[model samples]
Target: MANIPYREVLGSLMWLQVATRPDLSFAVNMLSRFANNPGRAHWEAMKHTLAYVKSTTHYGITYCHDSNIKPLGYVDADYAGDTDRRRSTEGHIFFVAGGPVSWASKRQDTVALSTVESEYMAFSRAVQQGIWITSFMDEIGLPQDTPVLIYADNNGAIANTQNYKNHRRTKHIDIRYHFVKERTANGDIVFEYIPSSDNLADILTKPLARDAVIRCCVGIGLRDVEAGGVL
Candidate 1:
């Protein structure tokens, strides 16, 4: 493992994730953390990601020509998923015309006491990006409708956005995370609940089974180009 070029391999994976591979975002993000002191297990995981990429070389995002499809966002979080720091991982993806336009997978800055806090934190970050996407669309003559819709699988987090009253469980949360509540109130964005089974952003928050991976890939417009319209 000492001889392995972990950082270089990670950089290549990072470029792939940023360029056209939303499915690899979480895996690459996780592996990048051990760059400075990677073990044999980390090296094996890096190899796995490379092999997966090789097998899916023909897969790419496919934009369907449907004008009715408008911009929408999905956000999710895995609470205390970082074993080293007890930090949560937040992930989100925004789509327009049936294809992802932007997406991210990042670790939370603070330790969340509950799953709801982790989710709400993720919501705040997604809203910031969501608002930017809406503004950019408007400037490009593709003005999106007001109150951009963002979907989350956590019912508690959705309720937190609507309920301004801070209780014992939530009062300790950072002031910045509360921005999601204000945005909901001022019509900048709206939070809606979706079943976890259907939340495409789930792939970006944690490691998943192969079946789930394919489902999310298809959901977000990634296609098996060599097979002509399959994921």
Candidate 2:
């Protein structure tokens, strides 16, 4: 007999992803789609994921005491990543005191015709989350200064955020997403271009090699208690 009900298994995995296993967010999100019609391959994949979790059960986020480090976020999009829908996946992670506290990885709600558009959509979503988180922090007495740094790997998306003039290319985008531009111009947020290789949010949108994944996890202060390693 199977170990757990499919729904229960999926729910538990989702909770883990949200709690302390951002590394598993993409994998769990992908696997969850197969819950309704899980074949043997899907079951095997789930079991493998569980095994990985068991092996790294002691790994968790490590918050530092430093408060001088600025709050920063990285956003990325995998253009046309989904094999079935050809929709991009938007991923973002926010860090404070050198550790990630908020992250998301999900398919874009709308189909973007260009990489710039996909990146713009993803950046906008990150900006919204950034604003909300900043406000929450402020309410809790961790108020940050104006203009949080938001990193995006796409130059076009960064340019779009810094400028308001609409060209034929960007005119097709929804008006709501223009909030990124408004926030940037109003000095509430700043968009910076980061090289794709250095964008930590990349881990959320796509699978990476083992080394890269571990590097990112370490960079964000995720420690493995069992291994006595602070990563």
Candidate 3:
């Protein structure tokens, strides 16, 4: 089947995402959804994605022990981004030692009715992942300080988690998704607003210009190591 090549292509992209290109994780994940019966257009898009990767093959996340910055996270969601189902995509990045250690891009299971709901869902997933990372770090004796910061561009979503008075609009959200509020109340994490320009997670959720992509990659500490540096 012609579609078989599409699956292999997507699988290759996924391997890149998991290995060195966390920046491509979300886009690859989104495109992989259409691999079952890819048309010519989809194949073209896949080629373009591959070309982009080839152009920036040197980029990668680097974790250096020299930096003292505390571990932090950034999260954002693209509201109703999927043209077919109007579903949102969630993107997040976790940084330690001034570099990204973990990140993800995934489509929301449920279609969000509003931008706030989409952002809330994204934040919820980020919180869950944050908890898991915190636990794992603790197990490794690298526990982070309290109030791990999570940045979001959506003010309404932050308000929803920080305050309980907006239930009129959010009452429809599932109880499981409301766990972000609990984490906020317990002081395990704090949600703050970050201007879109500074949201590193944007690279995961959308196609950006080459300059923006390079800037984000640098912010995540992906760089070319010199001969003097550790190999």
Candidate 4:
């Protein structure tokens, strides 16, 4: 396995992950990081992702035509999920017309000092995506007028964006992450705290039980084609 050239297969998986398989995004992202140094364990992980895809080939995002057309976002962070570097993974999913239209799962550029900081950065990145999407919608003649709501599971991070107080834990954070705060204040984007159990972005931040993944798949509008509904 150490001598195997795995880039081509990995690239195909990456394409599928971006195109339709939101569930495989985290696995693809994690495995891609090790593509150059793939060993037995890495190859096994790739095989696992392939197996998961084989089992859920019919899963896809369906845009419900008659529903909430405004874009809604769910953002979450796995606090220091990367064991080796202690970096957090940020995940976000944007829903429009009752289905997910865009999503992301990627490692943070720098290490976060705390869970609040990680969540803050995650929300900030979501805001950036939201802003871009809103602009694109405007160009397409479906301009959105309401604020984009970004749901977060952490209360401390939500409070940090709203209050802006330089508290001990958040005082040292970089100024760029506060972009979410500015948009939030202007009513362009709203940060709302939701129960972690209900945050669908959980799927993108880390691996979970099969049941949990199914629940998240439903949350983000990925449905099984066989039953004409969620699996």
> What's every prediction's RMSD, in angstroms?
1.2, 2.0, 2.4, 1.4
Candidate 3 minimal-lDDT segment of 10 residues: 222-231
Q: Which residue pairs of candidate 4 clash?
A: none
Q: Is candidate 1 or 2 superior in lDDT? A: 1
What is the C-alpha lDDT profile of model 1 across 70-169, one tens digit per residue?
Answer: 6799999999999999999999999988889999999998899999989988998999999999889888898867788999999998998888787788
Each candidate: what lDDT?
0.91, 0.83, 0.82, 0.87
Taking all chains together, each candidate's TM-score versus the true structure is 0.96, 0.92, 0.92, 0.95
Lowest lDDT 10-residue stretch of candidate 1: 62-71
lDDT of 4: 0.87
Query: Which candidate has the top score in lDDT?
Result: 1
Stronger candidate by TM-score (1 vs 2):
1
> What residue pairs are clashing in model 1?
none
Error of 2 at 175 (Å): 2.1
**lDDT of candidate 3 over 165-194, digit per residue (tens):** 646667777574468888999988899899
Rank by lDDT (best first): 1, 4, 2, 3
Q: Of models 3 and 4, which has the larger TM-score?
A: 4
Residue range 62-102, candidate 2, lDDT tens digits: 77786544678989999999888899998999988878889
Which run of 10 residues does model 2 get worst, by summed lDDT?
1-10
